[model samples]
Each structure stands twice: as structure tokens, then as C-alpha cells.
Target: MADVHELQSLLGSGEELTIVCHNNPDPDCLASALALGRLAAAAGIDERRILYSGEITHQQNRAFVNLLDVELKPFDPELVVDRSERSLLAFVDHSVPGANNAVPEGTAVDIVIDHHPAEDVQARYVDHREGAGATATILAEYVRDAGLDVDATLATALLFAIRRETLGFLRGVTAAEYEAGGFLHGHANDDLLAKLSTPSVSGATVDAIADAIDNRSVTGSVLLTHVGRTSERDALPQAADYLVTLEGVQTAIVFGIIEDTIQLSGRSTDARINVGTVLNEAFGDVGSAGGHREMAGGEIPLGIFADYTSDDDQLVAIVEQVVRARLLAELKLSEEDGGE
Candidate 1:
């Protein structure tokens, strides 16, 4: 458990606090930011704001925000730079200052609270527990230990965050996450959670999933596919989740091009294979990639797309071949092994 006293002391008095979430903020990131904002309020910080840079295009994430009335403002680089002297900056649900997050590189961070693998980032206070399932679980501990008031809205958000991050406790979950879920269960609104769980999927998501199915290639227990062009990057993860459910499939890697960037999402049920590490090894050299053991994501700019002036199908086919070969080689699989 992190020292609540130290966190409060870092905030000091009459200092504005800005809580920055990672790009394309998920339920865990949003809920963790809100929960920490509540902590700041309890610590007597009057001026504080929760900010995120990327779009929240996930249906469930949108529903969670609407159902809970969680407020998050857009990050303003100018405002952050201007307020750098008088304000304190804190990050939640992300460890490194700039990796895959809105915070600029080399920015001095006051506090960092996360559940992912820790990176070598300089911060005055960092509470990173790689064993924990969700960052919300860490914040829930602060709320519990400090005896802070957790309203129904915050409790429901925290509980939902934990559930989504852990895939209803089916993924990487520890005793701390279980305890947090149990504690938040008492205060969370059951009706609201049920509503948030059943978000309507968009047509794009359906098409993306179908494309993944059509393009899927299996080598032993590994499955890889490309969904072509996608309007929503979140659909890649949904497709990857669906692919991993196929019979005899131990790992699934799905990729799609979104706005001239190739986004990849991977899921693994095999305990011995860490999908995050696999993605980092495969794509980290050319792009940014990393996540938890069971789930991970990465993105690479589609500069190669400009090399081909041919039709879209041809371009996608070439890119898919390149990506598939790289991933298979990293996974120790080969095309000659009847993958296609």
C-alpha cells in the first residue's frame, strides 16, 4: 500500500493539481483519475482537473462515463506549460511520463499511481504494483485506508474499472483486486453496472470482427489476423478478444489500420507466454508497445502505406504480409507450418 500521508504531503496547500490519463483513456484510466481526484479533494486541494488526450471511442467506456457522470477535460499543452510553475502534475493508470500518454517527454511529474510494470521514470512519488490487476484497485486501497468518503458514483466507476481490466476477474487478478472489488461492491450501484455492461456495438465493430475472422491464420496455438482499415481503434481489441476464444487458440494478435497508423491488440490465455512482452519484442523497435501479461497493444505509423500507390487492397495485403511474417517469426512460428 502507498503512503497516503506522503501523497497528501506532495500535494501541499493551495497548489493546483492536474491528473493526466493515458491516450485513448479506458475505463481503468478514467476511473483511476476520478478516484485520485477525489483523494485530492479530500486532501483540501481546491483547484484540480482530470485530463486526457485521445478519444474515448470504446462503447463501454463512453457508457461508463455517461452513466457515472465522470468529467474529464481535454489536455492543453499550453495550459500545462504555463501552469508548470504553480501546479503539480500527477499521472494515473500509466507509469512512464510520456510513453503512450499525453504528458510530454521530460516533464517533471509529482506523483504516479499505476498497476502496470514499472518503468524508469523520475517522479517525486510513484506507487506501482505490477501484480495488481487494475489501477482502480490501488486507488480503492487509498480510499479504504484513509477512510475517505466514496460516493456511489465513484464506487460504481471503480468497481466497473476493476471488472473490465480483469475481464471479470478472469485475467490477471490478485488478492488485492479481489478485496477492492468486494469493498466497492457494497457501495456500487448494481443496476447501473448492469446497464453499463451491455453497450451497443457499432456496425464498424461488427465489420472489423468479420474481417478478422476472414483474414485469420493459425500456427499451432497462435492466431494472427488483419482487419484492414478501421474507423475505431478500439475495435482491434474487441476483435482480438473474440479471436482468442477460438478453439485450440492460446494466443491472438489482431491488427488494423486507423488513420494511417497500424494498431495492434493481443490477448493470451497461456500463462507461459506474456503477450505484452511478445508485442514489445515484435513491434517495439518500430513503434510503441507494452501492457500487462494477458493483454497488450501497440501502434506504428503507416509510413509504409505511402510507398505503394496501388489500390487499397494491394497495400493492405502487402502490409499484412509484412506484419504477419514479423509476428510469426517473433512467436517462433513459420508460414511453412500450415499457418494459412
Candidate 2:
């Protein structure tokens, strides 16, 4: 368990605070960042800036931001962060410099509070509880322990984040999450959560899911699909979630092209397979990838690989071939086990 007083003491030493959310901020990270902002304010840090990298293309994420009025700035590469005593940099939900974030490599980080699996995290105060389902659970622990008054908006964000991260207490849920949910239940607005649960779905997301269904292939107990190209990277995870329910499929991986990067989202029901470890083994050397046992994602850049063809179809084919081969090989699936 992390010491909330120690976190408060660390914040008290800083004059300014900057909370950074990982690339493509989700409810978990957004709520965690917002809650951290509140903590920093409570710690006598007046000036605060919450920033996020990448696109907020997810519909539910958009709803959460608009409804909760969670203020955040888009990460600007040209913006220079003052590293003097006036500034303190903190990361929420993600615990690294460049990995899964637009923050430059080797950048100084003061605080890191996250629930994901991480390695070589460099921060002055790091509270990485991998056992917790959501980073919000950890933040809730602080909020509950420190006796910081949580308003309805903040409470709703935290509660919604916990639910989303744990898939409604179905996946990756822990005791901390349940405890946090119970505490937040009184404060969180049920009406807001209902609205957040059913946000407008983009046509692009539906199209991507359709494409994934058309392109799916099964190898042993695993299903792999490529959606060709997509503007909504978050749709990959949704498609993965949908595909994982396919009959006889124990695991599902959905991938697609987003500009020059090949992005992937995977889910697994098989106890034998740790989706995060499988993804790291398959793609970590080529790009960046990892997550919990039930959920995983990867982003691989197409540098030399994109030069294989001028046509988009050819590029998709190449990516499909490479991704399929790599993942199946890592899973030790034989060609004889392949199916459509």
C-alpha cells in the first residue's frame, strides 16, 4: 500500500504540478489524472496543468471528458517544460517516458501512480500496484484515506473509470476495486454513469468491426483479424472484445493500420495464455507492447516494412502476413491448426 501522506509531502515540496495522461487517454487514466490534480491542489500546489498525448477518439472517453468537464491540454512537442523548482511532472496510469506516451525519452518524472505492469520505471515517488484492477482504485485509496472530499463529478469519473477498466468487475478486478467502488457509490452520480455507458458510436468503429469480421482467421484456439486501416485506434480493442466471444475462440487479437503504425488489441480467456506476455514476446522487439493477462495492446511502426508496396492493399496484406506469422509462431500453433 502507498503512503498518501508521503505523496502529500512530495507534492508539498513542489510549487507547480503537471499531470500527464498516457497516449489516447482512457477513463482510468483521465480520472486518475483529475484526482491527482485535486490532490496537488490540496497539497498547496496552485498552478496545475493536465496534459494528454494522441487522439481522444473513443466515444465514451469523449463523453466522460465533456460530462465531467475534466480539463486537459493536448501534448505539444514544441512546448518546453520547466524542470526547475517551480515545476513538478507526474504520470498517471502509465509509468514511463516514451513508451505509450508522447513524452520524450529520459524526461524527468517526479511521481508515477499506475496499475499496469511496468519495468525500469524512473520516478521519485512511484506507486505501481499491479494487483489493483484500475489505477483509479489506488487514487480512491488515497482519497478515502486522506479524507479529501470528492465531489460528484470527480467521484463519477473515478467510479466510471474503475468499472470500465475492470469490465464491470468481470475482468482484472481485485478487492481494491470492489472497496473503491463501494466507497465511490455514495458520491458518484448514477445518471452520469448511465449516459457514459452508452455514448455515440462512430461509423468508423462499426466499419472497422465489420472489416475485422471479414478478415478473421483462427489458429488453434486463437482468433486474429486485421481491420486494414482505421482512423479510430480504440476500435481495435472493441473489435477484439467482440471477436473474443466467437464460438470456440479462447483468445482474440484485432489489429489495423493507423498511419505508419500497426496497432493491435488483444483479449484472452485461456488461463494458459497471458495476453500481455504473448504480445511482448511477439512484438516488443519490433515495437512496443504489453498489458495485463486479459488485455494487451501493441504499436509497431512501419518503417522499412512500409516500403514493401505502394498500394494500401499490398501493405495491409504484408502486415497481415507478418502479424499472423509472428503471433502464431509465438503461440506455438502449427500450420495444421489453422482455420478460417
Q: Top lDDT: which candidate number? A: 2
| lDDT of candidate 2 over 70-135, digit per residue (tens) | 898988654425467657899999999999998899888999999899999888999998888999
Candidate 1: clashing residue pairs, number: 0
| Candidate 1 regions with alpha-carbon error over 4 angstroms | none
Cα deviation of 105 in candidate 2 (Å)?
A: 1.5
Number of clashing pairs per prediction, in order = 0, 0
Once fitted onto the true fold, the runs of candidate 2 whose alpha carbons sit more than 4 angstroms away are 77-81
Candidate 1 has an lDDT of 0.86
Supply candidate 2's per-residue lDDT for 99.
Answer: 90
List lDDT for all candidates, in order: 0.86, 0.91
Q: Kindly give the stretch of ten consecutive residues in candidate 1 with the minimal lDDT sum.
A: 77-86
Q: Where does candidate 2 have its weakest 10-residue lDDT segment? A: 77-86
Candidate 1 lDDT over 154-253, as tens digits, reads: 9999999999999999899889889998899989899999998899999988888899999898988899998998787888999888889999898999
**TM-score, every prediction:** 0.97, 0.97
